[model samples]
Target: MNVLINEQYDIYHVAHSGVPLLRDVKQLNPDVIIIDIESPNRDMLENLNKISQFAPKPIVVFSEQQCANTTINQMVRSGVSAYVVGEVNQKRVKSIIDIAIARFDLFQTLKQELAETKQKLSSQKSIDKAKRWLMETKQLSEIDAYHFIRKVAMDNSQKMDDVAKNILSVASIF
Candidate 1:
């Protein structure tokens, strides 16, 4: 485990003790979560689901009994990025944390990029409509209409999509 203990303290290895680690998880914002539950209590697994919902971090699981498979599978479905077995040997905790954290970071990056792309696409549609309105009312060419919105954005130091919104708002008032 010492080999896996990196300089960055971004991983939290905790046990299920009837205490929700939501606050700690958020404060740590750990890239990886290693949960060790010595007791297969139903409440503990339920608590894991709740934790996963509140703070979705990469997770690797270990239990006292191998029969915890169903709950482990449920955890994976609930945003546990990676799942593995074996006890939480203090000697190996650090290595497990490192691997899970790396995988979680990659997944988060992709999720953010996709969300940004969707936002841009939605804004493009709004801008296009404003451009079309300019073409009809102002009798401008497509390129000129687009440039007109861009010019307003530059003058106001606002986003092009915001300028388009204002254009639509004023036009709609009539």
Candidate 2:
């Protein structure tokens, strides 16, 4: 918990069993969770999914059970960090937490970045297709069609992609 907060995770509270961990997490709105459970807790996972549906975060679970592939898969699908089972290594636990948080952070950033890039690429493709349509219909050169599209984009104070999408829609109708 100390390391998590130090790493800028904004851990709100360190909760123990017999207490409402799920409720506390929802109220506190933590960025990540680390659980030291003797066995898998289905309720915890369900509560995590409920909380994560709207606002997702990292979850780590440390258990004293046997390290099996099936259990690992289950825990991950249930929203948890690597299920480090058997033998407690304080240093290793801390290291795993650090790695898990870092990994989660990177995954989120990469997903956003990739989505943006894909959107741009998709828009560019549409714009190019629209320009090609105008060129064929007007018998205009590629450069002229591009400049014409650019002029319209600037005149309307709209993005080139938006203008291109409009062009595509109009051309498709005809």
- State which candidate has the highest TM-score: 2
Deviation (Å) of 153 in candidate 2: 1.0
Error of 2 at 113 (Å): 2.2
For model 1, the superposed segments whose C-alpha errors exceed 4 Å read 1-92
Top candidate on lDDT is 2
Clashes of each: 1, 1
Tens-place lDDT per residue, model 2, 1-174, is 332444544654566444475566557654334543233543564355565653332223333343445644554543335332234564665555555555545555777899999999999898899889999999989999899899999999999999999999999899
RMSD in Å for model 1: 13.7
lDDT of each: 0.58, 0.61
